[model samples]
Target chain A: MKIAVDAMGGDFAPRAIVEGVLLAASELPSDAQIVLIGREDSIREIFKEHNFESSVVEVVHAEEVIEMGEHPTKALSQKPNSSIGVGFKLLKEKAIDIFCSAGNTGAMHVGALFSIKAIEGILRPAIAGYVPQLDGSIAIMLDIGANADCKPEVLAQFGEIGSLYAQYTFQIERPRVALMNIGEEEQKGSLVAQATYPHLKANKRIHFIGNIEGKDLFTNKADVIVTDGFTGNILFKLGESLYEITKQRGIQDDFIDKTNYESIGGSPIIGVNGNVMIAHGISSPTAIKNMIGWAYKQVQANAYLHIAQALA
Target chain B: MKIAVDAMGGDFAPRAIVEGVLLAASELPSDAQIVLIGREDSIREIFKEHNFESSVVEVVHAEEVIEMGEHPTKALSQKPNSSIGVGFKLLKEKAIDIFCSAGNTGAMHVGALFSIKAIEGILRPAIAGYVPQLDGSIAIMLDIGANADCKPEVLAQFGEIGSLYAQYTFQIERPRVALMNIGEEEQKGSLVAQATYPHLKANKRIHFIGNIEGKDLFTNKADVIVTDGFTGNILFKLGESLYEITKQRGIQDDFIDKTNYESIGGSPIIGVNGNVMIAHGISSPTAIKNMIGWAYKQVQANAYLHIAQALA
Candidate 1:
């Protein structure tokens, strides 16, 4: 199986990406290979500087580069040879088992939708964030920043799809799904949240655990936390910021350490046709390496296929 | 100044409330007095149990109690002699300097509206939460859990009223007001949030700062953080939970310690005609004591009068 890395992505692209790929190469199984997609010369230069040589890592040249600030749909069409563009092409063709990037989040999201596309019967594909739990486990929170304004039906669908992803990927049978809201009551929340609660409760595919308040975020209350992209994105980022806030104060704890973005590295765009993970824009070498590890696990889980099958 | 509290409110009512009042009575200024509103016998019994005696503490009898789960409007009308009802009556008649409760949040909000009513020109009154800042100061976040779904106008007004409250109550001149959003960009949020941006920016009364994400919650980015009640309530509760999660893990930090709900105690309802504050239903004696302290500060600040003057 081939795992593609966008070498010309993120703030410290090429160097950080290449160095991270090299780090991941050492842990990869014999059946797996890392495909570095970018300008071949730049990737080789980084490898040479690190005094690194690996038979498991291969470079695929892409002439054009999509800058971090470029518009998603426009850049994908205009710069077809861009690293992100080519990476999606390879993913669509199944040349790579999974595609991971720390590039422009919008471009990556747009590229995935335009390439492999959303799975059949999917209303809207969502970005799923990994929330570290107090019990050393992780919960999957969907629509992190994908659809900022989702309807009630859309949010309810997230609960269903997110449950499937968590069950198959994380191996949690009948994963407990909860709606992220202001209160624990079904009737308490914004109009959209209030309306979505019943839909989630009515769904028989997953274990609906009712509403989970903000205080229950890291308490291992549920396996899948579903919300619209707007609230989910803010909460996810806030959760990630805890690691930096605590670290700056010279405070250390086992659970707090996992809050670091580098621990999980990437958030998968679930409900899509194939495996696609998007990392932080400021992702470091360690973060990239960790992302690749998760990428390998996602490839193994084949959650997208399960979602498609369930929907079908 | 006379500060009134609902002794029959909260999970540990009468006992915790009376004990807390005694705690505050010792520290209150000579001119200030504590008016305990509930069954006079129950309060005196707790005061007797604690071996506490103070000239500053007085008791007022209210025959009925508003349970935590009771409907706000229904309970207030049916139980006219309830603690919350008597407290609001005292506040309306100017018999008390300020009224605070840890009971039925909805009743307190509804009572304030029905009694003192909202300040003239105010579309809606909001519950303002005190967010602990990294710099050891506090930022005022409005609409914590008052109106779940706020229109753009209501949210924009929160920014203005919140700014005024922060400036006068916190004694900050020209407080920086910011919109709480998913992203830092103006156009990047839900439909209501996007529409509210331009309104906040155009308001001449506030020192409007751009968007502040959830990560910026305690970063001292702004003095007044504005958002709809749904998002604001969840974020506030989430921020408060950090203290407990960290404490359970035996992690200690000066900054994280401030995240404790007991640190400040109560969240004040802004845009109301009178000074009204509410605490957690599970408030302990320490929390009640601290809330009384803030109640004293609120009376001194006279923030409600200032907001009324500004709108006029």
Candidate 2:
């Protein structure tokens, strides 16, 4: 199996991406293969500078690069040879097992929907983020800013997707799922929440816990918290900002330390036909390395196969 | 002006409420009056225990009490003699300039809607929370769980109400208003955010800034952030949790310290016919005292009257 990295995707592309891929390449299993898709001349030059010229990693040269601000759909078609575009092409052609990019979020999302498409019978493929718990364990939340407006059926299906993630990715058996709402009662919150409560409770794929409030975010009460992308995105960014504050103030705690994005690697676009991870735009070399490492793990787990089967 | 206190409300009722009133009473203008509404016997007994028997405080006996978990509309009607009910009665009768309680949030919202009603032409009354900014100043965000569903017109009106609040309460002139969204672009986010953008931009009452994402929560991007109650409530509680993390870690930054809910007193229920502040459920005496203090400032600013005239 081959894992592809979009070396031209992030803010610190080429340098950070190349170094990160090399770092991941060193730590990965000897049988695992790495495919670097981007401008070949630059990546080769960097590999030579790092004195790893004989590295076994394969390089796939792409003629163009997508800017961080480019429109996802337009750029994907207009710049077919762009690293992100080429990476998607390789994944669709079965040349790469998974693709990872720290580039344009919209482009990654567009690629998941248009390039490879979602799993069959899936209403929508949502993005997932890692939420740190007070205990050593971390909970995974889904639909984080992908498909901002969700109907009752869509949110309920998130329960299924999130459950599969818990079982396969986090290795939590029979993950407990809860709806993110303003109040703990099933009847509280928005119309969408009130409408979605019964559907989630009736879902047989996962254990549905009652509603979880904001205070319950870092608690061990629930293994999976589900919500529409709008609310999920707000909570996701708020959590990110808190992590920034902790680091900025030079505060240290075991639980707080676990919320750092770099440590978690990246967020996955689940339910897509092929497995993919999108890193932060400003990610460091360590973060890129971690992203690659996690991508390899997901490939081993075959997250896409389980998701497609479950949805089917 | 008479300020009414619900002595039977909140987790630490009677004792905390009475103490907070006295703390405010001591510093209030000589002409300002405070009426403690609850079971008069218990309040006087606590006053005696605290050696404040000689204090010139007014007490209005209330025959019933509403527990924190009781349904809002049902509790308000069933217990007319409850502290919250009587407090609203006093306000409607023009006997109290303001009323405050760290009681059931839903009860307060119901009372605001039914007891006194909203200002004329108001679509719905919204509750506002004070968001601390990085520059030591704070912005006001509205519709934080009051009305779960809002039309575009209602949100546009919130920009106006929030602007008036910023100018009169926070003392910022012509406050910059913004719509909270999943993305910073005009075309991004949920349907509500997309629909509300044009309304806010066209509304003549506010200085409408464009979309603001989650990362700008603590920034100086906009002075008043407008969002549906569902999104706002999640962010509100998330902020509370972040502050809790800071306290637990013993992080000591001036800005981070300000995020403490206790220091900010309470959130105000805006767009109502009278001034009402709702403190945290487990508020300390200090938080209660600060709530009363801020209520006094709002009274001086005549926030409700200004909101009424602006809406008219």
Candidate 2 on B239-273: residue-level lDDT in tens? 77666766766656677767778777788888889
Report the number of backbone clashes for model 1: 0
Clashes of each: 0, 0
* Stretches of candidate 1 exceeding 4 Å from the true structure: none
| Model 2 misplaced regions, further than 4 Å | A54-56, B29-31, B54-56
Residue pairs with colliding backbones in model 2 are none
Interface RMSD measured for model 1: 0.8
The lDDT leader among the candidates is 1
lDDT tens digits, residue span A1-312, model 1: 899999999998988888888889999888899999999999999898988887799889999999988889999999999999999999999999999999999999999999999999999999999999999988999899989889999999999989988988888988999999988888999999999999998998889999998888899999999988888888888899899899899998889889899999999999899999999988898999999998988999999999999999
| Candidate with the greatest TM-score versus the true structure | 1
Question: Taking chain A by itself, what TM-score does each prediction score?
Answer: 0.99, 0.96
Angstrom error at residue B258, model 1: 1.0
DockQ of each: 0.83, 0.68
